[model samples]
Target: MSVATLSLFRFASLRSRLWVIGQMALARRSAAWAGSARFVKLCGSGSGVGFTPQPNWSVWAIFAVWPDEARAREHIDRHPVFARWRSHAIEDWTIFLSPVSARGSWGGVNPLIDPSAERASRTAGPIAALTRATVRPQFALAFWRRVPDISKVIGSDPKVLFKIGIGEVPLLHQVTFSVWPDAESMAAFARQMGPHARAMQAVRDEGWFSEELYARFRVLGTAGAWGDKDPLADALAGAAAAGRRDAA
Candidate 1:
């Protein structure tokens, strides 16, 4: 089974922050990650709901796809670049994911393997949805104009456990990741006749993105913390409680 790991690094000092910035380019050519995985990307984040135009230099992410959990864990244990990043980061977190469903292409191919494709009816667990896009230059302004409303909607959504805007490029390439209690809640948010729906419609009508990908994952597990706590703790606890009640 293929596994995906999204590792977030938070640098506090100015020097450490500058080093991570340099790694954005150097890490690409490093032997550690070079040809070492099914896919790899170094990403920067945005401010506010992570949708704004301004960049958040202090936080960066390493997203990679591996053959299995063993290989993924091995790399995380011994990869020098990863170790260095963690050494500098005041805080960091990594989440392991197994694709439940994925469609479209990213950088010309969808790197995730949907292990549950044949039997993926488990919409009861924690669900993470990732959407990535390469915006066309002509439609950049128009696309961004619609983001604030979408961001606001998700930001205030009580059911949204966690959400962030991360991307490869400032304006040209954008990615959004969000976690929902279940698939139904996620679908409700996406399909509701509101800003998200309207913007999605505009994308189809305007062809705003040259390339796009959408993938959903079943949360395997996590290491470390975000904001000093696992963002999924409450959600997972609720799911566990619900399961126990059903068994009782």
Candidate 2:
């Protein structure tokens, strides 16, 4: 099965943090792991929503799609870039996922499994949602104008366990990764009559993005915590119970 991994690294020193950014950029183009990886993206987080033009020098992230769990594990365990990150980062977290649904494209290609191919055995597990965009130069102003309001709507939502805004470039290339209590809860928030929906409508009406990708994943497992505790602990437990029931 296809697997997606999201890794976050926190650095203590500014120099080291900046150095890793350059390293990740270079690795994206030249690393052997990148060659084998289905999709690879190096991202920076916004201070508040974790997706602004203002740089967050202390934290960085990597999002990758792998053909299977074994390859994803092998790359994380043995890749030189991963080693480099571990050496400089004070703290790191990685979450492995299985695509439940995906739409649009990243760099013009969809790298997730088709949702129809997988059976929807249960519907109570945590849902991981991703929304990314490469904004058109002319639309940057309009796009950012709507961010704060829309971000507030997302960050304040009761269903959201965790959410962060990340991007390769500050404003132009942006992405939001969020975890919700369940798929239904996530859909309700997204489809609600709010700033988020208005922003989506504006994006379509104004042709805001040159490229975009939106995907949802099933949280298979997670390593480490976002803060002091696992954000998806309850959801993971629910998933485990569902799996056990399915096996019976």
Candidate 3:
């Protein structure tokens, strides 16, 4: 199956941050150089969990999709664009993920192939979810008005291993990514009756977005750390230990 990778870069100084920010447009050519690349995106992060309007100049990310893990790993290591950003970053982390379930569209179509929901449910590991949208110009205010509450809701969830607000365009195009210990915990939050649920209802009733995509992933592995830790380490380790015991 196809795989996706999200590589995050953290910079210390204002100069480095600005330089990475400029890569949003500048790095496209280099990213396109990959012969087998399926999808490529350069993203800037938000303050806090990424819902706020203020940009977090210190952190930036690159998201890509490849045919498989080996090719994805190869490109990220050799790609000049990624190399340039890493050279300036004080810290960098990359996590590889496999899609379990996906719906709707991303940039007109979902680039990654998703397995059945049943297959996703059977997999025992850390779960990651991605929600992306392009807000209709007319509903931009109403759309943004509900973000802080959603951010607060996710931020307070003890079950969330990692969460961040990242996007392509500053206001109109946005994406939220989060990691959970399992599918059950992740689904609980999505079904929780609060700002997050309310926003989903509003989207269905009022149609605030012109385009959207939602997907779930299984954490395959990690190459580096975020906030000085591999956020999914303990949970993933526990899952692996259980699997080993069951096999024996």
Candidate 4:
């Protein structure tokens, strides 16, 4: 089955951050790894909390999709980029996921999850949601103006375990990754008749995004910690309980 991993890195010092930035730029020049054998697609991005364009130098992230879990694990264990990140990051977290549902594309290619993958028999577990978009130049101002309020709504929701705003370029290319307790909770926040809903309508009406992708994943497992605790611990535990009850 197709597997995906999202890794977060936190650098405590300025020097480490600069080193990572240089390495990220250098990675793009090496064409040999462009169509890597193990990973189907990979993206490295700067992490931001809200809609702001400013770079958060201290934290960075890498999202990758693989043909299977074994290859994904092997790449993480041996890849040079991962090695460099390990050396620089003071704290890091990685989560493994399987596609629950996906639509749209990233950079004109739908890489993270395959739509044809068989659905899990259980659909009520922890959910990982990803939304990516390339903003049209003309609509950039209007798009960003509506972000802070929508972001606030998502960020303040108690059901959301973890959330981060990341992008390749500061303003034009943006993505958000969030983990929720369950699919229902995620839907509740997303389907709310508020700024979030209005923003979705604006995207469709104003043609704000030149390209966009929205996807959901089933959380398989996670390694390491964010802020000294596994952010999805509670969600995972609840999923485990549900699985046990179903088995019984």
Q: Pick the candidate with the highest TM-score.
A: 3
Query: All models: lDDT?
Result: 0.80, 0.78, 0.81, 0.76
The TM-scores of all predictions, comma-separated, are 0.89, 0.89, 0.92, 0.89
Candidates 1 and 3 compared: the better one by TM-score is 3
- Give the Å shift of residue 148 in candidate 2: 4.8
The sequence of per-residue lDDT tens digits that candidate 1 reaches over residues 1-248 is: 88888888889999999999898898876576764567888999877453556688888998898888888887876788788889999988887877887888888988985554443746677888888888888888887777545666777888888888788889888887888889898888877637657667678677888998888887777788888899988777788888899899
- Per-residue lDDT tens digits for candidate 3, residues 1-248, read 78899999999998997788677777877435558568888888888674556677788888888888898888778777778888999888888988887788888988776443244354687899888888888878877776445767788899999999888877777888888988889878877846656666677578888898888888988887888888888988998998899999
lDDT of 4 at 172: 84
**Comparing 2 and 4 on lDDT, the stronger one:** 2
**Runs off by more than 4 Å, candidate 2:** 113-122, 146-148, 245-248
Residue-level lDDT of model 4, residues 1-248, one tens digit each, is 78888888898898997888786677545463554433433344543444556677888877878777877777767777777788889988889888877788887777765556678634778888888888888878877777545556778887788888777776788887888888788878877747667767767677788888888898888888899999888879988998899999
Estimate, for each residue in 137-162, the C-alpha lDDT of model 2 and write its tens digit: 88788777775455666787887888
Off by over 4 Å in 4: 29-50, 113-116, 120-122, 146-148
lDDT (0-100) at residue 170 of candidate 2? 78
